[model samples]
Target: MDASELDIVDRPAASARGWRVPLLAFARNPAGSIYGTVVADSVLAVESERQTKLSDLIYAELITVIVYWFAHVYADFLGSPPSGSRRASLHRLAVTLGHEWSLVTASFFPLAAVLLAAAAGASIQTAALAGMWTGVAALVLWGQLAGRRAGRGAVVSFAYGMTAGLFGLALILLRVLLH
Candidate 1:
């Protein structure tokens, strides 16, 4: 079957009875639950290393942003615990990790593209073009995913910008403090 014609069904749906659907849904949607786990890991990595590069820092921030959007999307689509409830707090924390992961994933594409272009001795214009296209494409993909799952593309865009800003700030602070 042609790739476009192949109806990709999640196999886990078969066994997803009762609470399994919610759990598996969260698991499968990287933006949903998986994002939280990824952020926690990145944070821990930074904490353990005691230092990080600008690129790495931006990457972490971006991931956190995506993760936040994911959590927002999930909570919005599938009712969440009442705001400020213990359960809600816990869920938010987990979702935070997932956002971090998504942001990091998003950042990696652009960074890698730019670096590869530079290494190849491409012109400055070519490097910038590669980075810009890669970054935009990644964000668009994420936004489309967000739209499908949450009915909001703005959330994805917001997260992208917010993550970059926050992470960039943190990195600057860290550099100043450590330097």
Candidate 2:
């Protein structure tokens, strides 16, 4: 059949929910947390000579998260600005940059939660667990939303959510094992 003779699929207008693209982009950008955990755990494990406190471990991990987050943000900022003749007003530019930067920043929230919990005198182990779960939950929710947007059924969407969570967790496990 000639290309023009094929029927078009009725679909969503791309401009609608345009914000979702960036929101998903922000949600998906946090691989560094795993890397940070591994690095922090390994360094603290080796350097302390004695056992490190749970608070200390989580704090160190949080620092690593921030460092990796910073690198990611800086790199993105360099690549994020609009190119060529496309120009935005100062306010638009500010908003664009803020949204772009959020992609890198969102990953830190989980670790920040851990930090706050620890500061409040919670056990590092417990706080870390909560933080990790928070991140995983975010991933799963994002996945579910994504699947729904793609017209998946409820079961399929739930499965997609678990898949996203498990995939991220697997990467985290791999980093932990390797480090």
Cα-based lDDT for every prediction: 0.48, 0.54
For residues 1-179, write the lDDT of model 1, one tens digit per residue.
66644434544443546664553343345343223323433342343244234345345545665666666666553565466677876777676555444433545555566568768986544553455455444444444444445645666755654453343344334534653
Identify the runs in model 2 with alpha carbons over 4 angstroms from their true place. Answer: 1-96, 175-179
Candidate 2 achieves a global lDDT of 0.54
Clash pairs, model 2 backbone? none
lDDT (tens digit, per residue) of candidate 2 on 16-135: 668765655554423333333333333333323332476466456556555655675566546665555445444555554454443335456555766677788866555655566565
TM-score of each: 0.37, 0.47
Residue 80's lDDT in candidate 1: 50
Top candidate, metric lDDT: 2
User: In candidate 1, where is summed lDDT lowest over 10 consecutive residues?
Assistant: 32-41
